[model samples]
Target chain A: MSRVIQIAGLRYRYPDGTQALDGIDFHLNSGESVALFGANGSGKTTFVLHLNGLLRGEGSIEICGMRLADGTLEQIRSKVGVVFQDSDEQLFMPTVLEDVAFGPLNLGLSPDDALTRARTVLKRVGMAHAFERAPYHLSAGEKKRVAIAGVLAMDPEILVLDEPTTFLDPPTRRDLLSLLRSLPQAKVVVTHDANLARALTSRAVFFDQGRITGQGDVIEIIQRFHWEYS
Target chain B: MHHLVIDRWSRGSSSLHQRDPRAKLAALLVFLVVLSTTRPGAQWAFVAYAVLLILTANLARLPILGLASRAALVLPFSATFALLTWWSGDSLRALALAEKSFLSGTAALLLVGTTPLTGWTAALESWRVPRMLILVIQFVYRYLFVIAEQVQRMRWAALCRGPKQRGFRLAAGLVGVLFARSWQRADGIYHAMLARGFRGRFVPAPPAPFRSSDALFLSTCLAGCLAIRMLL
Candidate 1:
């Protein structure tokens, strides 16, 4: 019913004069799951970084039509949960419980509340038994689950996942995809996997060389990209 | 996997390994202080101290040699002989000093090797150590092994293909990389800790408390130490 995230004329270039994003306009509706499909260096990571105010570009980003600003950055981040591509980088804490507790703790939840939320999310991700295990001691699939739980504990309404299935074995990937599909939030996913994009979202946008190539059904883009390239 | 560092030191079945870390730490420190305060080799006194340390180690099932080697690793190049030559006093004093230091080191190793790092940290909390100090110690102890492992892995990886000298540079660069990685890692950990609402005090896991046997064993050891220091 409402545009939860809106962007227009977003242009960003690295200081070394390499352009990463150019004239990007995108919007995410409330409770919509959208997939951003692109090949390598298609500026997907840069775009998601802007969502959480981790980067700045020439374009505007409006969450529920509010402009990104100093006060709003934290609010935007709190509302928009982002799981980075590398679970290794994301799950850097000593123990699973501690990592899961981090975001809520930052939000100033009491220790018991933080522990409660942490335990709940860990159980949701099927990692309840891994509460005391260190990050380096986990399997890749388990680490990814822990990372997602870390974000889930924050209770964000919008989830942005960057390449969630990378490095996972087939079974682990399937589990992760199923988990993603089950989340009730509005999701904007950036991935190179076409079938995953088709399986997870009703809407799809193709990005290439710093600009949008087309926007339509994921199956259509998949067929179109293959046809044009072949 | 119960990969406790304490187990690395011993396989002993003694109740000392299961004792409260706070009591052990306090006792060990007191023993070390008394030994240090004593003038060099009082043979009878030194023998008694050595027997105490060895007895503790034996009971804890810790490898005395492994602990001793580790303790001696921090020694300067000039050791027993150098002390013998350098000391203005008699050779007995030199021997005594070395023996005393060795006993102190053994006591420390026995304490640490028997107690889990987390348990020892909780013991610090029990002793009213400042929260910030405990946090700092915890972080340093937790990451030290991580950083070491990373550095070793990096070196090994580089050594497989590169020249030895080149590998050294790469490994040194890895050390620098580790510094950056650890800083980033520390930031992530700090945030993760903050998110989890970790304010300060370490959460102590209450293992089974002291049994009658543990008290009797500690009391016997305590009595022996007092007797050795006072009587002999």
Candidate 2:
């Protein structure tokens, strides 16, 4: 498989001197799905943020063979779609259609085309009925679907989902997992759900205090980290 | 919750709601200017303005009572100044002061109540309003509910801990924590925007074409307001 993302010696420090990410190396092949397992504040989120140039750390990073630099930032962003854990943060437009259209509109698509793409993706995510609904008015599951639709509307090559199932209930989580599995793009999922990781990803990477502690088969990594409770 | 009601009202399919936003905005400006300049003693003009607003609200299919009550939100502020004027021995002027403020508020509400936020905001953009100011308005409107919900949850959590939590001290602490949480949310929102390839300015949706009916609507409003100013 061809490499879709490559990073070397990645390190990031917040303004308050917190070493959020420290010398991390990671890679994801095209069409591959990987799960990131870590305790809260273990730098999984920070690492994925660098994949799309949202959080630039001191490192050499590449997305779809394009260097993550100033000139290539926009292009790289269009290649790596990040669905934030909080759907509220991502779905900021007044209506569902507009929120989903936001990314396509940003990519210089004409309004009509963007709206068309948004509608198509919303339909794909089973949120076609919510086209005119306010994002805040939707239930958590619906909001999550719309959030995914928003990212999907961008037609990115790689999907970086940060806690995609954060607030979803059992049936909603099952629906989400199925919807996610249907997408064709490679994925980097930052999650804590062991079953989710096992079901959705072939490989897993564990982070500890801003560094990778283990990387292997999904079940192996989960077992090594004692990531699940009986 | 009032805004939510208005939001729902704005999405209705009445003739008044179908009027172009630019026409509605211009009509609002003309109404406000005419009402503001009407002499304080012209009680008939004030009555006419109220009738006009009521007629328009009915035409828009909005709940007249809801619109009136929401518009009365401005009265408390105007009543303070009206009280001063009344104490200064000009009760008519005091009444007109309150009248002008209420009429103006209702007229403005009529515009927004009929036109969705995007419609009017896009109208403002077409008029060459400062992009920065429009951006601020859009962002605040979009996130106001999210922040309000957060505050509600925080308040509930505090109340759950103890009944004595309903005081200025608790409010102050909530405000502080809210400020910090809002800050973090803002950061997350900005990052999300970046992830979607937002380059400084928002990509505006294409503006709707202004039709001849919209022109006629604006003309009717202009004539009505001016005639009221001269005759009443």
Best by lDDT: 2
> TM-scores of the models, in the given order?
0.74, 0.93
In order of listing, the candidates' clash counts read 11, 0
Predicted candidate 1 versus true structure: per-residue lDDT over A39-115, tens digit per residue:
88888877887886767888789986669887776666677788877676677545678778777776777777888
Q: In candidate 2, what are the lDDT values of residues B131-209, reduced to their tens digit? A: 7888888789989988998988998899899978688887998999999999999999999999898998788878899
lDDT of 2: 0.91
**Alpha carbon deviation, residue A32, candidate 1 (Å):** 3.6
Instruction: Report iRMS (Å) of candidate 1.
Output: 5.2
Q: Give the 10-residue window scoring lowest on summed lDDT in candidate 2 chain A.
A: A128-137
Cα lDDT of model 1 by residue, B1-232, tens digit = 1234443443334677667776777777778777877666567888888888877777777777777776784355336554755576567765765676667767777877877555577778777888678778756755665677778887777777755557456658877888898887766554434333245534433344756665666677678887888877
Winner by TM-score: 2
- List fnat, each candidate: 0.12, 0.84
Tell me the TM-score of model 1: 0.74
User: Interface RMSDs of all predictions?
Assistant: 5.2, 1.1
